[model samples]
Target: MGKNLREPLLKLLIEQKEGYISGEEISQRLICSRTAIWKHINELRSEGYQIEAKPKAGYRLVYRPDRVAPEELIPHLSTTSIGRAVRYQRSVPSTQSLAHEWAKEGAQEGSLYLTEEQTAGRGRMGRIWHSPTHSGIWMSLILRPPIPLNQSPQLTLLTSVAITRALRKQTNLPIQIKWPNDLLIHGKKVCGILTELRGEQDQVHYVVQGIGINVNATESVWPEELRPIATSLAIEGGRTFSRPELIGAICGELETLYDGYLSYGFTPIRILWEEYAGMLGQEVTARTGQGSVKGIAKGLAETGALLLETHTGVQTIFSSDIEW
Candidate 1:
């Protein structure tokens, strides 16, 4: 089907889910021909939508897909800026890579890059992220904030809070932010956020916030090696969630927090992040690039750095791997 008619047809079918939408009505609503409407409906079917058609009853949307397509996400999304323009792909090496290219090409803020699978998905410190097709959300968000480079790391913490809030709203589970970015459920990793920036020393460019969530994969679905250290929402909750809905929720939540951060400051988000943090005020060990620091997690400093109180003194850790 032509790209022009795909969204309109889908929207019309959804609006008429309680009943059938005749081909003539769809063609008239979209200002296209009946044949065009028929083709678009067939295309929707091929994309996993259960669109029913009859000679006289027309078409009814019996079921929509769980895939991360714009047709599925954009219509249902409530965000004003974030995710206003989405680039959805069946497979990609990494959403972050594509988002960087888009940023270089001057893509607008809040533009999103989504993929069903990532062949080369990565986490902090170049660690490989396991992303299986049709089982998780592997997406990147583009942001152009007027903040200094030194303070940009706070976005990772803010994103952590956003995702934690979204998950709390959706699943009502006890989700915790592990240090900088990883989301933990019962001590197992369920989501990870990677934030990247491009620009000069003082002035800023765009920041790419890449997020990967283990949504529907079950215990057996994960690799034998990852089974012990990783888990999905389905594995923890004994149920699955709609990926598109979750994606939309996260974008909306991020948009709200990001707007607030731009207008006010990081203090609000910092408070929330500390509240949702897993090891605040607890004894833990953080391994930085320079060395390791073992102490009581004193919480976050004003600059979003980790404040660890060791026997020697209280040291501010800018970057480190947390292990409690």
Candidate 2:
């Protein structure tokens, strides 16, 4: 069985919606032998797909696992190449780490790497991102931009805007962007973005933007520490969302913003991001390695740094913990 045969077989099974599909039918439609069809079915099953097989009744797709695959997402995706090329894994240590390695090895820009679960997912400031199996979107993208290294933080802001837009498109839930790189739903954390860059002294060589969204995680599925403050799309929307749809939306928005940044600059993205950012124009506390500072969240600077109006004066905060 070839790679091309799997997609048509899956689509046929989905379209048929019948309890069983005969091996003779699959073999005829795919123009392959029954043995070849069986081989491909086994391959699909190995990839966590649940298929029921009977000696005479043939096969039936009992379950389609919530995993990000190029075949599943690309057909419905509306973008140039942001998610056109995907490397999907059932489980991995970290999608970001894998994306970083791929980017370093000259992977194409807009390449996406996703996993069903991440064992060592991380968030901003070295925080651990809870990515459980079959419950969230654990994905990373490789981007090659001509922007300077100092303007890299803007990428994080851009990603936030993209994710927020995607969530809004799929569900009517009100989503807000926390300062820097957190996505909140009804004032609870629902998503986090971690952006990393590898470059020279002046120019950015590549950037790996990692995003994790709590899609279908239930209250009991979350850790005790996060139950109070964390949430999932299912909890917020009262239903589970297609991870592939959300991923496609995010990748499309990202490509749009990336093109905008290259043409006009970060000014447009900064404006849009500020509109959705939480704590802006409100009293907030910022915790940094140096110390903590209380200030009013004025807005973001043109360079994407945090503009904090402190007691002494206005400050440009590049990175810090935001508490509102």
Candidate 3:
């Protein structure tokens, strides 16, 4: 096909699965020819779709793969922009690096770069992120919000709320957020967010928010040292989940909250964040470049900074690592 037909065609087949959809009807609705539909059907089959075809009958959807490709995700997605355009690969050095490059190359806002594995995945503070193949979510989302450069970090906080709220609603899991961008289940780390921006002194061009989730990975996926503090959804939930479904749910929640954030301000998202926050009322240490501050994890400031209730008073920490 001249245009991208896989996404819409997949959606049509999924929605019209009450019986076999005739090829003539698909071509008419999608505004294509029967031959073109046949070509795309073959393409989907190559990608592990079990589409049944019969002469003079049509196509019937048998099964779909557990892949995170756009064809597999479009049926589950309901957002206007977020995850509308996706760049997928089996493995990469880093999806964050690709998002930066693609954004500079004029990729659209809300373009998502996804990978099953990342050989050199990066975390905050230049740490290496462990990315296992076919067992986790290693992806980055591109956003071009019309916010000031200093306010970009709020998107990171908004992302934690989006993912946590989505997972909680879908699975009834007790997922909670740590200050800034970490999500935990039962006090063990399940997801982490790393936000980077391309901006000038006053204006922001775009923001690349990378999110890593241990979705269906088992205990062996983590390194021996990480077992004490790290966890995956399968470990806590005792079952595996569809990665594409989780991604769609997160994107839907994100697009909603993101639209609201741009309209009003951070007030609404901040309120939701506090409700899902973890480690509050617990004594913790934040290590900053100048020094360290020990205080109780109270809440967040308006600028997305972690608020700490110390003995002296409430200390507002901007950039620091939390130690508990």
Check candidate 1 and list the clashing pairs: none
Q: Each candidate: RMSD to true structure?
A: 1.3, 2.4, 2.1
lDDT by residue for model 2 over 207-241, one digit each (tens)? 99999999999989878999999999999899998
Deviating ranges (above 4 Å) for candidate 2: 17-32, 46-62
lDDT per residue as tens, model 1, 1-324:
379688777878878757998888887778988887777778788888998778888888898777888877877689999998999899999999999999999999999999999999999999999899999999999999988788888999999999999999999889999988899999999999999998777857889999999999987766799988898888888898999899989999999999999998999988999899989888999998888889999889878999999999999999999998
Please give each candidate's TM-score: 0.97, 0.91, 0.91
Instruction: Give candidate 1 misplaced runs (Cα > 4 Å).
Output: none
Candidate 3's error at 139, in angstroms? 1.8
Please, what are the lDDT tens digits per residue for candidate 3 over residues 1-324? 553888888888898775788998999999998888888988888878899987777899999877788777777889999999999988899999999999999989889999989999999999989999888889999999988898988999999999998999877889999877789998899999999999987888999999999999887877899999999988898999999999999999999999999999999998899999878888999999999999999888999999999989999999988886
Sequence-dependent TM-score of model 3: 0.91
Where does candidate 1 have its weakest 10-residue lDDT segment? 1-10
Query: Which is better, 1 or 3, measured by TM-score?
Result: 1
Each candidate's number of clashing pairs is: 0, 0, 0
Ten residues in a row with the worst lDDT in model 2?
67-76
Predicted structure with the largest TM-score when compared to the true one:
1
User: What are the Cα lDDT values of the candidates?
Assistant: 0.90, 0.88, 0.90
